[model samples]
Target chain A: MTPRRILLGAAGAVVVVGVLEAVSRSGLVDETSLPPASTVLKEAGKLAVDREFLVDVGATVREWLLGLLLAVLAAVPLGVLLGSVPLLGTASRALVELCRPVPSVALIPLATLLFSSPAQTNMSLIFYACLWPILVNTLYALRDVDPVAKDTLRAFGSSTPAVLWRVSLPSAAPFIATGVRIAASVALVVLISTELLVGGDNGIGIYLTETQQGGGRTDLMLAGACWAGVLGLLANTALIALERVAFRWHAARVEGIA
Target chain B: MLEISGLGHAYGTHRVLEGIDLKVGEGELVTIVGPSGCGKSTLLRCIAGLVPPTEGKVVLKGAPIDGVPDDLAVVFQDYSRSLLPWLTVRDNVALPLRRRGLGKAERRAQAVKALASVGLEDAAGKYPWQLSGGMQQRVSIARALAYKPTLMLMDEPFGSVDAQTREDLEDLVLQVHRAEGMTILLVTHDIDESVYLGDRVVVLARNPGRVRDELPVTLPAGRDQIGTRADAEFVRLRAEVGRLVRGVVKDSEPPDATDAEDADAEAVATAVEEPAKK
Candidate 1:
C-alpha cells in the first residue's frame, strides 16, 4: 500500500467516526441505543482482554475457515469439469440457474432444523453461500481461457490432461483467485449472521447477543460489531496480499492492459 | 521424409483444401505460400495432426499420422498464446522433454542450450509476456528446437513481428535449420519470405484450396537479407512466387515441363532440384 492511500484511508475512517460521535453526543436517535466512537473503542479494548470474548472470536474464525476450505475443495473440480465439457455445461446451466439464486441465508433455518447443532448449522450456511461464487467464477475463467493456448498444447502432442494442467489451470488462476477473494468476505458475513440467527455455542454474533441482553452495555455491543467489521476488512486485505503474491504474472498482465 | 496425397478438408458445407499433394524429403525445408484464407494453416494443421484431414492422410516416413507424432514440433503464429505464460522461458522450452523422462537438471541444461541457440539465454528466467514480441517468438522457436524433432512446422512465425525483427528471425530460422538439419515446413502469406527461406515454395489457390503450383527457389545457399534480395536469382524467384501465389500466370502452360508427368515425377523433380542453382 502507498503512503497516499494510507493517508486517504485514515482520513475516511476519521470522518466516519467523527460523524457517528457527533450523532451520539448531539442526542439524535437516543445515544443509549447507539454508542459514540470513543465509548465503542474503550469497550472494544476491554473486550479484547476478555477470555470468553476471545473464545467466541476463535470459534467464528474456525467455522469460517473450515467452511471456506470445504467449499473450495468441492467447487473447483466440479467447476473445471463443467467448464471443459461444453455439453455438460449446457446441461447443468438450468440446474445452476435454479440453485444459484436460492439464498444461502434462507437455507439457514432448514440447516438449523436438520443439523441439530449450532456449529454445523453455521458451517453448512457458510459452505452454501461461498460455494456458488467460486464454482461459477472457476467455470467462467476456464471458459475464458485462450483457445490459442489450448491449440498450442494440442499442436505440441500434449495429452488432454496435460493441456488442462499446463494451459487451462494457469490461465484461469487469476479468475479463481478473484472468486476466492469475494467468497472470503461473504463467508465471514454468512458465518456471523448464521450464528446470530441460530444461536451458536460461541461466536462473534452470539457474543453481540449476550452483550445486548445484558442491557446498558450498548458500548460493548457496538464494540463487538466493530470487531466483525475489522475482521471483514482484514480478510479482504489478506486476500489482496495473497492474490498479489500468487499471481505476479496476472498483475503484470493487468498492468499491461491498463 | 513426409508426403501428402490428395489431401482435402472442409468445415461443414465449406471446403478448405482440395486435391492437395506435397512431399518433403529428408533434411528438406519446404515453404507453403498462398493468399489469406487459402487454407495454408489448414494444411499445416493437417500435417501437424492437430486436425484430422477429411479426405487424405499425411504420411511421415511411410507411416500415416493419425494424431500428433512423437518426433514432431510446431511453432504457431501467436507467440503470446503459444507459450504457457505461467512457465518460465526455460521451463516452456523444456516441456517436451518431460515426456522423455529426463531428470530435472538435464531438462534445464537442454532448455538453456536451446535458448542460447536462439540468442535468448538471458531471457530464460523471464515469462513469455515479459519479453518483447520478437523475443517471445524466438522463445517459441527455441522451444521447437529444444524438442529436437525430426520434422518442424512453423505457421507464419514472423507474421506478428516488425520488418527488421522478421528478417532477423528468418535468418535465425535458416541458421538453426542448417545446424540442426531438421526438415521444416513453414506456412506464410509473405511471397518474399516464402521464396527467401524455402528450398521449394508450394503455392495454393483459394476456396477449395489446392496446390496451384510448386516453384523451385534458385537463390544462393549463403543468404543475407540485403544482398540476397538484391541478387538477380532471388528477385526473379520472388517475382515468380508472387505471381504464382496471386494466380497471375501470363501463359497457361505449366512453368516446368517435367510437371506434365505423373504426380510422383513432379514430386521427384522438386526433390532433386537445387533451387539455389536455377
Candidate 2:
C-alpha cells in the first residue's frame, strides 16, 4: 500500500473515533454506561501496565493456540479423505450438515457439564467453533483442484497419494489458509466467550465481568473488550502476513482475478 | 511401437468408440482428425491410459497398457489447468522428475534446458498465470518435453490459443519432434492442422468414431508454415484430406460405396474418347 493510502486510512479511523467521542460527551447517551474513546484508551493504557492483564491474555492465547492446533490435526486428514473420494463424501455429507449448523456456543452448557474444568471446557468450545471452517474449506479447496492437473499427474503414472500431495494439496493450500485465518478469529472469540459464560480462573472476559459487577467500571470493561478486539485484529493480520509470505503465487493470482 | 485394436468405449450406454484400430510405428507422428463430438478425444484418452477401453486393449511395446505408462506424456487442451499454478514455470516442468530422485540442482538444470527448448528460459521463475496463453502452453509443452517420453499425446493442444500463437505452437511441436525423435499422436478437429503436422493423418468418422480414411502426407521432408502451405503438393494433399474428412467423394456416393465407381468412371472416360475418335 502507498503512504497516501495509509494516511487516508488513519484519517478515517481518527474521524470515526472523534465522532464517537463527541456523541458520548454530548450527553446523548450516558457516558458511564458507554465510555468515550478517551476513557477507554486511558483504561487500555493502565491494563497494558498491569501484569495481571498480561497473564490473562497469556491464558487466553494458550487455550486458543492449543485448540487451533488440535482442530487442524483432526480436520485436515478427515477433510482430505472426504474431499478425495466421491462416495465417502456423499455418505459423510449428511453427518457434516447435521453438525455444522449447531453453533459452537450452543454446546457450551453441555461442555461445561461434561468437563469439570474451565480450561477444558473453553478449549472444547474453541475446537468446536474452529473445526468446521477448517474442515469445510479444506474439503472445498481439494474439490476445487483442477481435474486436468490431476490427470496430468496420473498420465505420469503417479499413484493416488502422489497425485494428492503434488496436485491437490498445493492447489487447495490457499483455500485452507483462508479457512485457518477465519478460524483463528472465531477460535479467539469462542475461547473468550466460553470463559465469560463458564467463569474461568483468569481471563480477560472474567476480568471484565468482575470489573462490571464491583463498581460498574464501564471503562475497565470496555478496556478488556478493546484488548479482545486488538487480539482479533492481530490474529487476522498475522495470518494475512503468513498467507502473503507462504503463498505469494496464490496471492498474486487472487489479485489478478480481482 | 504402439498398437490399438478393437478399441471400444462407452459412457453409461452412450458408446463413443467402437472397433477402432490404429498402429503407430516408432518415431512417427500420427494425427487423428474428426468433426466435433466425434470421440477423437475419447480415442486419445484411451491411448494415453487416462480412460479405460470398455472392450479392447492398447498394447504398448507388446504389453497391454492397463494404466498410464512411465514412457508416455500428454499435453491437454486446457493449458491453464495442465500446469500447476502454485509452482514456478521451471518447477512445473521439473515436477515429473521429483520422484526420479534427481537432486535439486539437477532438476533445475534440466528444467532450464527444457524451457530453453520451448524458448521460455527467461520465464523459469515466473508463475504460469504470469505468462500469456501461448507462453503458458509453451510451459506445458516444455514439461512434456522434459519428461522425455517415448511417446507423446497432444489433445488439440493449440485449440485454446489465438491463430498466431497456434501457428507458432505448431511449428514448435514440429521442431520438438525433430529434436526429440519421439512418436507423437495428436488429436485435432482442424483438418488442415492434422495434414500439416502428421506423417500420416487419420480421419475419424462420427457416430461411433470409426476410421474414415488414412491419408499419407508426402510433403517435402523439411517444412515451414509459409512455404509448406504454398507448395502445390501441400494444396493437393490438403484438399484430398479435406474431402476425405467431410465424407465427400468424386462418385457422389457415401464412402462405404467402395472403389467400384472409380473403375466405372475410367471405363466411361475411355468410351467417350473412342466415340470422339470415330
Model 1: CA > 4 A from native: A214-216, B248-278
What lDDT is obtained when candidate 1 is compared to the true structure? 0.85
What would the per-residue lDDT of candidate 2 be over residues B1-278, giving only the tens digit for each residue? 99999998887766667888899999999998765556777788888898888988899988899888778889988788888888899999998987667998898899999999999999999989999999999998999888888999998787777778988999999999988898999987676688789899998876566788888889765788899988898788878777776663335543332222122222222232222121
Task: Name the weakest run of 10 consecutive residues (lDDT summed) in model 1 chain A.
Answer: A208-217
Model 1: pairs clashing at backbone N, Cα or C within 3 Å? B218-B275
Error of 2 at A66 (Å): 1.2
Q: What is the lDDT of residue B23 in candidate 2?
A: 95
Name model 2 segments beyond 4 Å from true.
B99-101, B248-278
True contacts kept of 2: 0.85
- TM values, all candidates: 0.92, 0.92
lDDT of each: 0.85, 0.84
**Candidate 1, A198: how far from true, in Å?**
0.8
List, in order, the clash count of every candidate structure.
Answer: 1, 0
List each candidate's DockQ score.
Answer: 0.55, 0.54
